[model samples]
Target: MEVASVLHMNGGTGEASYAKNSLLQQKVMSITKPIRDEAIRRIYNGKLPKCLAFADLGCSSGPNTLFMTCELIETVEMLCRELNHESPEYIIFLNDLPGNDFNNIFKFVECFKQNLNTRVVGGIGKCYITGLPASFYERILPTSSLHFVHSSCSVHWMSQVPKGIENNKGNICMASSSPLDVRNSYYHQFQRDFSLFLKCRARELVEGGSMVLTLTGRSTSGPLSNESHYIWELLAEALNDMVLEGIIKEDQIDSFNIPVYYPSSSELQLEIEKEGSFTLNRLEVFEVSWNAACGEEHNDNSEGYKVAQLIRAAAEPLLVNHFGEAIIDDVFHRYQHILADRMSKEKTVLLNLVVSLTKTT
Candidate 1:
């Protein structure tokens, strides 16, 4: 499958859209706010440009997109006030795949800018927001153009499905049941893709500019040991249940794989060192309960249902591409019951990793 063409969150502000289901991602940004703030502050102190340019790579549509942009703007404005320096003009790039919901994002631009002008203390400077539809795996910005680069819950996505995983049947992701070769194939693909990511961003960032990235990750060395695997494990179970009931064919499940990997901190460090363009300044690992971000607002929904909706908003496009749309709802409904049972027995938490980097070249 062409990941770039099919990989996008459910668009629009409807009930199932990413805009409504992205509280988890927003919570992650909040968790890593200190690192992101420090990086931006470092750049401002080192050299505050007349027009501060930055890009929110893999910035999917929603309140979370606005949240990141607002934080950046507010951070700069606060700094300017304390330092007694003139506020710099802002050039913010909202970047994502070509298939992303750029229309929805644009709808918020005018209103967001209007609010910024009236809300920020002492008022803010001129701010320009643009939609950049492209892949971060490739160079999408001019060399030495960005002062600060930020990406959240995005870089774990592989550019494409790894080759030679055809044998990884009965699983939709790298599971414990996957063969050794299948596991190696996934890791090798992550290594190549992440290394290229660093190289691409390295070229786009100015020397000494900062980058902060946060993604779903694992605390342990084993690839399948993370809670992220349980998401797919339950998904696989749901598919298997359908296969038994003749809702879908067994071969269909065997033929599909999710193009994502959750790397351990050691693995991430190794890739940064091998890429040789950016210096890794700080790395941190944190955990969040599966239901922590959604809160009591979703109390009417079962714990399993809440998590299912979150995954559906993110994974529906990909699932629809592989399986027909007919079985999408059934799949998640089954997944919800399975997850609910599991979570009831034990508290489940997702591991997250945040890293800060500096362009050295």
Candidate 2:
């Protein structure tokens, strides 16, 4: 699949839109708030430039897109207030693939900027935001332009599906059914993609500038572990059921695989070091439910229903692109039932990785 052309959350602020369904990622942003604040604290301690650049990559449309930006502005504002330093002008870039719902964000962009100006500038510190549609795997801005870069719940997406996995049947992601070679293909793909990410960011960031990334990843149990692989396992089972009933072709299963990988903490560190561009300041790994921050009391849906909504919001675009919209409803319907059944037995979660880095060159 041409993922860049296809991959995006359900656009607009409607019910299925990522704007409403991204609470899980908003929780991630909250979790990493301290780390982000610390990075900004250091920047302020050194120098709060008169003009600065900040970019959030894979910043899919949602309240979380502007939500993160708000936190960033707040961090600088709070730090300057505490330190008695005047605030600076900001060139904020919100980036995602071309298919992202920039229109949704644009609808309220001027209002958002005005709010920031009123709160931060007081007619003094000017803040600007622009939407840049492109993959974060490549350079998105001029060299040494960005002072702080942030991305949450996005880096796990591989730039493309792994090569040489066509023979691995019935599985869309790395799971128990995947062969050893197929797993290796995913690992190698992540290595290449993440290395290029760090290298490209290295060129874009000023020396001593910081970056913090939070995304779904794996634990010590490795890539094939149940905790790491259950989401896809259930999804594949749902598709296989459809195949059994002839709702979809078996070959479609073979051809359609998700371009997603959850890397281990070690895998992440290895790529950063091998890329030889940034100094890894801190690394954190935490476990959050596939349904994290989602509460049963708020809705009547089953746990599986909630989880399915979360995954569907983030992944439905890809499913629609590959399978056509005809089976979209049926696939998720079966997927919710399968996931609900699975969650009934045990509470499973994803291992999350948060890394803090500073550009050295």
Candidate 3:
């Protein structure tokens, strides 16, 4: 499957759009607030620059997209106030796939720049914000132009499905039952994608610049850990239920594999070391309950429904491409029911890894 063509979140401000459903990711980025601030401080460190370059990679359209950019600019503004220097002109790039909804995100840029302008004690500087439609897996900007980089809830996505594991036969993602070779295929793909990502960013960032990345990841139990992959496991079950009802073919499920792979901290560390571009400064894993970000209580299975919407916003386009648009509602309804039953019995949490790294000399 061509992931970039169909991997975008549900667009616009609809109830199911990623704008509303991504509060979980917003909350995750909030937890890393200090990392962002510290990285900005490290960049200035008494010597304020005349121009600052910032890039928000994988910046999809939503409240979260502009919300993220504003935070970065605000961080710089606060630091400039402390240093008694004029706020530097910003070269901000909000980047995503070519198919992303750049239109929605651009609407907020004017307001973001105006807000940043008001706080500057002197006249406003040029905070140039523009969208660059390209994949971060390869070079996206000119060399050594960026001073600070930030990516949240991206980079776990592999550029494409792993080779030699087309069908994954009966599974859509890495699971406890997956064969050793299938697991290795995913790990190797992540290693290669991550190394290249670092390499590209290294070339773009000025030496001593810092990058902060927050992405979905696994805790212990290794790369094949079921705890980290329970969502997909439940999804596979939901697809099978649809098959039993003859709503969709079993072969469809057999041939479908999510183009995402959540890596363990060890795997992430290994790739960063091998890439030899950036030194890992701070790496941390946090456990977040599935229901933590969703506000409403779920005595009536509403929690399951919300979980389905959240995941659906991100995964539906791909599902539509493979299973046809006809089955989306039915498939997610089944998934909602399955998840509600499971949630009523116990709690499930997904691990998120937040890392701060500095470009090597």
Candidate 4:
């Protein structure tokens, strides 16, 4: 499958758009704020650049697109204030695949800059924003240009579907019923993609540059036992129901596979070591509710519906490309019902892996 062409979140601010349903991703950014802040502090303390160029890879559309840019600017402003130092000029690169909603994000740029002019203390540094549509797996930036790089809820997506998972039928992702070969194929693909990611970033970032990445990951050593697997299982259940009803062909299910992998912390560490261009400073794992509506109490039905919307916004394009657009509503409706039943029996949560890294000199 052509992941870059088809794997974008639903665009625009419609009810099912990623813009409306990305509170869960925003929550993820919130959860990892301290780590990102610390990385910025270290970069500033170690070597403050005159023109700090930072890139947000896989910067999908929505409020979360510029969330890091704003946070980083605020932190630098605060640092400059505390030290009575001059604020450096800022250049922010918002990057994602070609199919991403760059137009939607750009619509808010001028407004964001105006806010910065008034909100940034002393109007410290002039900020520039640009939209870069490309894959992070390749070299997208000039060598040693970036001082700080941040990506959240990204990089878990492989560059393409693994080559030999043809037998992984009845499922769109890795599952417990998958054969050993299928699991190995997925892991090997992640190893290659992530290693290349590190190598490319090592070249793009300046010496002593810092990166903080947050990814959907598995808590346990076994890939299939994680919540992500179960989540896909639920979707597959919905798809299987459609197949039985002759709404979609069984071969379609057999042929479709999502190009995402949830690696364990150990797996990530190994890939980093093998790449040998960055030093791993911290790797933290945390869990959050799948519902995304934390702090408020909601019945299973409500929570389930919320989770379904979140996944639909992120997964709809890929599904539509494979199964056609006609079955989306019915499939998700069935998915919500299944998820509600499951939530009534037990809670569903997503495990996130946040890692901080420094480009080795």
Clashes of each: 0, 0, 0, 0
The segments of candidate 3 whose C-alpha lies over 4 angstroms from its true place after superposition are: 116-124, 221-227, 296-300
lDDT of 1 by residue, 268-341 (tens): 99999988888899999998877864756655356888888888998999999999899998999999898788
lDDT of 4 by residue, 110-130 (tens): 888778768886775888899
The digit string of per-residue lDDT tens for model 3 on 1-361 reads: 9877778878888877888788778888888888888888898773377999889999888988877777777777777777777778888899988878888887777887677567555545677888998999989999998889999988998898888786377789877777888888988888889989999999999989999999889976465553488888898899998888998898889899997889888888888888888889999989777785475554555788888888998888889999889988888899999988888787677889999999985
Q: Clashing pairs in model 1?
A: none
**Model 2 residue 97 CA deviation in Å:** 0.3
lDDT of candidates 1 onward, in order: 0.89, 0.83, 0.83, 0.89
Model 2 poorest ten-residue lDDT run: 293-302
Model 4 regions more than 4 Å off: 293-297
Estimate TM-scores for all models.
Answer: 0.98, 0.95, 0.95, 0.97
Give candidate 2 regions above 4 Å deviation.
117-124, 293-302
- Segments of candidate 1 deviating more than 4 angstroms: 298-301
lDDT for predicted candidate 4 compared with the true structure: 0.89
TM-score, candidate 1, is 0.98
Looking at model 1, which ten-residue stretch has the lowest summed lDDT? Answer: 292-301
